[model samples]
Target: MAGFFKRIRAGLNTTIGFYLLVVVLFWLKTYLTYRTDFTLGVSGGMQQFLLLVNPIPSALLLFGIALYFRGKLAYWLMLIIDFLQSTWIFANILYYREFSDFLSLGIIKGTGNVQNNLGKSFLEILRPGDFIVYLDIVILILLLLFKVIKIDKRPFKFRYAFSITILSFLLMFAEYSAANANRSGLLTRTFDNNYIVKYLGLNEYAAFNVYQTQKESSTRSKAKAADLKSVQSFIKKNQVSPNVSYFGKEKGKNVFIIHLESFQQFLIDYKVDGKEVTPNINKFYHNQHTIAFDNFYHQVAQGKTSDAEMMLENSLYGLPQGSAMVSYGSSNTFQAAPSLLHQAGGYTSAAFHGDVPTFWNRNNTYKSWGYDYFFSDSYYKNKPNYNVGYGMKDKIFFDQTIPYLQQLPQPFYAKMITLTNHYPYELDKANTDFPATQTGDSTVDPYVQTAHYLDQAFGEFQQYLEKSGLAKNSVVVLYGDHYGISNNHRPAIAKLLGKKSVNKYDLAQFQKVPFMINGSNLDGHIDHIYGGEIDVLPTLLHLLGIKNDNTIQFGHDLLSSENRQIVPFRNGDFVSSQFVKSGNTIYDSSTGKELDLDNRQKKLLDEQQRFVNDSLSNSDKVVYGDLLRFHKLKGYQNVNKKDYDYTKKHALKQLQQSDRKHQTSLVDQNGGKSTVPDFKTNAPELK
Candidate 1:
């Protein structure tokens, strides 16, 4: 037994063993920071067993230290391990805070999909000072231990160390087994961080628990029946239907809804190299029925692209903080676009994207959204590939969509999302298919080239519409999905545009995208109104002579003659007109101006908070249930579009009263004594 013990000690003292130990410790730190304990409950027996064993790599290092201590070597390796671990922990802490803030404000829910350049930019803004502070703490501890601890007399016995290591390894294995007990079953106890606290230390477990609880609570509250009911009541009592008196005077129009991917308005620049980079878009903006929404902002959550799409199409609430596309897609209960349109106006709806329908679970969501047909990668053949993983070129997507447009029955709604302008925008060198127009050594220049290509494609699609005889009747609306995140090109873009620095908010022009409605029958006029992707649905419905009886829409029609209120969801807050922006000064909406700014700002902020809370907490009830009940009561088939006129007037009157009441109450709640003067209570007469 003595000989065997000695041999084991000798084996562990090898250089390879020391490196392995370090590697194990590094991996454990990563797992602890990134991997939520929630998985322990989801997996069946074998998977749980594996997860429990996942901590073995972390535990082994403590034992390996004694066995492989060549004093100096051990010290350096430990230092390196500590440094890496500290960095990872610090990064995670920042990410967690940002994610939590975003969730609290309803900007995003808490799925950790920060893949875009804008995502990186947001991360950069996330507490850099806090990260530095934590890093300093780690350094201080390391210094104190290295200088003060006397290691010469410290006990380093092989048997004792081995025993502890074995014990830890066994414990980890047991934990893994517990995690894998049942894959499909709701193993809440095992998965919950609060439960894990029974074994893990309080600090580690608490960090995860706080995050999880908030997320779960938020999601449940949003999807709750009571909340949905409130929204429905509010809508039924407020929303006004547009009169169709002018419908026959105006020609039947073509509507083009372009959902741009990660576009931000901050990216729009008038000149580059003394030449306009986006001249066509600028011209369109100047000439068309353009509504320049300056205050419009994107509240991207975990499933960034999908969340934007959902908010725009369905006006449905977002997922719980932690639940994103991967998890949300697994369920079929979420509200959707097509169903609402079909119910409201009998408009034939279709969805189009330039990728696999399965990506982001759009296939499932689109089907649920009530789209009669969906065009995806499967819909096209013999198309030139963009050489990226997602799908074919945007040009192809647009070109192919033309055929489908011609065939779709009249009074149809088509949603087209393009993709060629996606990140890593390099023209393929190997394929001779799409000839390169511009070439440069810098990586970012390719993205510019790609953007140019996308612009050209847009122009081509417009030409196709005109030639195919669809221009006179169709209405085309285009906008970006989110801001592009490629960091390589930011500096170049800034330099080209003559900007000081390029950040997420500054890239708002990219998010600004192009939202224009052009049809031969439509007048060429510009409407500089603040709006967002969420408003698109209501606006379109209104334009099509469709009345929205659903109470869940948080958005109002941009064309409506009401006082425009634009609210952009950012991380855990909102950017509104009330938010004062001056020369580089970002203020909390309330005190954004020099203390003397209108007290109404405070009321605005409070109103926004109430709006978000009410919207989130009662989404399903407000959006679907109340509307459905109302429709059912009146008889869905029996009531024609004319029936909504009285409801519209009544709802509009109630909404105005409610808005005033909310404003007054919110201001009072915020400790402000200011009172809003009551406006005329008379409702607008429908033509």
Candidate 2:
């Protein structure tokens, strides 16, 4: 035992042994970070093994290059390389702590609002335990200081460096293969960043993110005007006339769009433990003033919530990969809902979200979309215990925004985004009166509780609107942004949903999201119309009595008699009342059985395919080619994003200016007294 200790100490004093020590330390740091810090789905032995091995190649590759250099230069290079890699890992850890998402080049460029708002309090995300990540560096510096392992004097042989590089590359290849086998298409699929970091390492995920951003940038630049022709003709031919009965019924009324985050249609009247999951939303859905769609789905791609916003606001499809709002929003020209309503109805348009303005690049996107005002985290007083994952709790968010919402002029178009029900649904125990499901999956259990909380918040907001006299003359549109739980949680969800089994078809059906519109003048009807987020803007436009005859909208009016109910998903899937075409498999909508389509059915499927393809193609063309810049709608002026700013100071100045410019502001009308009450919630965090 004494001899073994002496040998180990002697070996560790060498340069090669020190390099190996660095690699091992990196691996340990990653494991500790993955296991304790972030929820990277490191469950079974297989996943644990993947996490353990994935960090090997990156550490080796980064440090191995230092072997080629000599003396102090070599030692310094190794330290620098290790530090750079560590920085990347540390950045991801911080970002993932807040977003439950990995950092990317595009996100980095777009998160100015986050940096500016949170920079002063950045220590909030760190913990004393996280200092372990730097312990290895400290040890190395101490060793050099104490002369335990002096810098190597010999020049590193070419063969040694070459061999190390080759070994690192091979290990990396093996890691990719293993991850791909376990999580099919780990390299190619439109997947969540968490999955990538779980199976493949943070370093690899960063590399992939850079590559994807560059590829998207390349595609955007290469887009041509000629590409717009097919999509334009297809859209023109598929236009549906608006329903005369519902047409202009709520014309010039206030539009209040409530964006429900991570909400699904399944929770409308769903009962868990014999208690309603979303009672308030259910009641509102069934109210005589509400028109709810039973078969509506969210067709968001990799962008998730942001994609839904892009489609709902612009009547355009999100990109095939990554967030369109983040990737192309600043550069693209959009004739979106805010601009359209402002131009057509003399309406003041504003969007209220209790999140970082730079989230999804919304600050830039909203400006480009011609929003008169945007109330984001900068405008919100995110007091202690007020905010949670993503942003402020839904109740607090709604309560705080009422003053701003009221300040908008009559016949206004405003969107309020809720945030409590976001993914990996977490709520303080004190707030949760509802019992969790015994699904053994933590994500599946809280899904209902947070949704219930959201429902209560909505009910409170609705009551406030009624009390303020805004409900009578307003069209309140409630929509689910995207699916809360992903396909990874499908099996557990299937058991909770009381299904014997679930497949791709069942997973596709899980994408259904709630869409309800309530107004005093509009008649209530349960419409079984099949549509997606892309159809929202045009449908609202018709209700507001706007003529979209010359506008290039890809979606048809859901209220129209000739409404094209064929909804296209971003991932080459289409769903309607008749059938669901997902990838290569077709399924009967009414029955869950597989379809053996006859000649007529096949021909219809082909036509639907063309329509879906052409629609997506055209929408992409509009975004990629900046087509809207060339074709200005009559009466609509070009939006100058540079003219608008959503900084805290600027936002306040604009609000005050609006108060002065238009005495119609509710704050002025109420003699500077706020109509909103302090927010109250059952959340344990508040207690």
Candidate 3:
């Protein structure tokens, strides 16, 4: 035992042994960060193994280059490279803690303001646990400084160094193969950053992001007007004629788009222990003035809420891999609803949400969309206990929003995003008297309580709007952003839905989301329309009396008799009035059974599939190629993003100036009195 200890200690003193030590330390740091700090969403043993091995090649490749040098220079280079890699991991750790996202290459190269982006001070970014990253480095430095270790002067042959570098490249390719085999399209159809970081190391993910960004920039530079020719032709050929009766029904009215987070359609009148889940929204669905769609689905994938927003505003499909909103929204040219209504009609547009402006890259995207103002989390008090899931509780959010709503210029296009009903549905007891589902799944139970709380908040806000008189003048539209219960919790979902099992077709049906629109003097009926998030823009455009004949929108007005009810989801699968295509097997939409199709029916299905594929491909071309920049619209101009700013100070100034100039604000109409006191919430956080 004594001899073994001596030999081990002696070997560690050598330069090669020290290099190996650095590699092992880097690997440990990365794996530990994956397990402890960051959530790359490791699912099973395969994913765990992938995460375990992905860090090996980067650590080897980075430190192995130092082996080509000799003596102190080699050791110093290895140490510096190790430190820089650690710094990057540390930055992502701090960033992931706040945004639940890795630091983008844009953020890394653009600013030194980490504190500003994370909403943390310099010291707050550094937690006590973070010191673990530097512990190994500190120990090595101390050993060298105290003369406990001597610099090694051994000659590392060229063949050995070359072999190490080559081994790294080979191992990296092997890792990519394993990742793709585990999950096909792991790289090509990249969905979440977490998947990339999990399958490949953080260093590899960073490299891929740089490559993607450069590729997109090059594509944009090479874009031309001719690229939009096919897209324009397809859109014009398939345009739906508007219904004369419904056209201009809500023209010149204030447009209110309520973004309901993680809300699904089944929750309407869904009972938990004989209590309603979303009673208020249910009531509004049956309201005399509300046109509700029972078959509306939210077509979202990796982008989720951001994807829904992209389709809602632009009438364009989100990218298949990642969110177009975060990937291209800042730079892409959008003929969006906000700008169309603002330019074509004399309307002011604003978006209100209790989250950070940087969430979904909305701060820049909103500017590109020609929004007059964006009211983000900084505008609200956001006091302690006020934030639950993503941002401020919905009740508190709506209450805080009333003041801003009153201040916006009248006939405004306002979108308020609610956050209380988000996933991992947690809530303080005071805010919800509704009991959670007794199911064993922790993530699936509290959903009802949070959803019920949102319903209460919506009810309170609607009544307040009525009392404040904004309800009478505004076209209030509310829609669920996406599904709260994912497919993984199928057993629990089946039990709640009183189903023996939820098969693939049933799961496809589960994608249905709630969509409704209401306005004064509108004899609203339940429209049995098969539509998705894509159809929202054209439908709203027609109602608002905005002409879009020359535009390149892919969606049709839901009210139009000629609307092709072919709703393509983010994935290749699509839903239609007659059938639901899950993978390759088409199921009868009503019965959820495989279709025994005749010859003509098969031909029709094939043609429908082709249309869906082309729609997705053309949308991708328009986005990646940025085809809109070259095409000119008659009355439209590119949004001067420089004209808009969403900071607290500038937003306030902009609102006040617009109000002074127009004198048509709600506050101005209400005799210069604020409507803040009218709205109330039972949120115990407020108490």
Top TM-score hit: 3
Q: Write the per-residue lDDT of candidate 3 for residues 1-687, one digit (tens) a residue.
A: 999987866877887788888899889888999998885557789888999989999888999999999988988888899888988888887766533567766555433321123343224446789868877788778877886777788867879888999999999999999999987887675355777898898999889988876776688788888989999988888888899999999999999999988899989878988988888999999999999998899887656688899899998888654567777777888889899998888899999988878777888888889898899888899687998866789988988888888988878999999988876576887787998887676668888999989889999999998889989889999999888887656788788778988877887888799999999868979998799998999999999888778887878899999988899865567898888987546898877889889998889888877778778878877989988887799989888888888888988988888899999998899899888888877767777
For residue 137, give model 1's deviation from the true position in Å.
Answer: 20
Cα lDDT tens digits for candidate 1, 216-334:
54553345344444555765654645535323223334456776654545445444345544555656556554444444555454445676776777665444333334444433343
Pairs in clash, predicted candidate 2: none
Determine the C-alpha RMSD for candidate 2 after optimal superposition of all C-alphas. 6.4
Selected candidate, larger lDDT, 1 vs 3: 3
Q: Which ten residues in a row have the lowest lDDT in candidate 2?
A: 113-122
Clashes of each: 66, 0, 0
* Residue 170 lDDT (model 2): 95
lDDT of each: 0.48, 0.80, 0.83
Per-residue lDDT for 437-528 in model 2, tens only?
77787657878888988998898888888777778889999999888776656567688779977876788788799999999987788999
Weakest lDDT window of 10 consecutive positions for candidate 1: 678-687
TM-score of 1: 0.59
- The segments of candidate 1 whose C-alpha lies over 4 angstroms from its true place after superposition are 1-224, 233-254, 266-269, 288-295, 320-326, 333-335, 382-386, 429-445, 486-497, 501-511, 580-600, 620-687
RMSD of each: 17.3, 6.4, 6.1
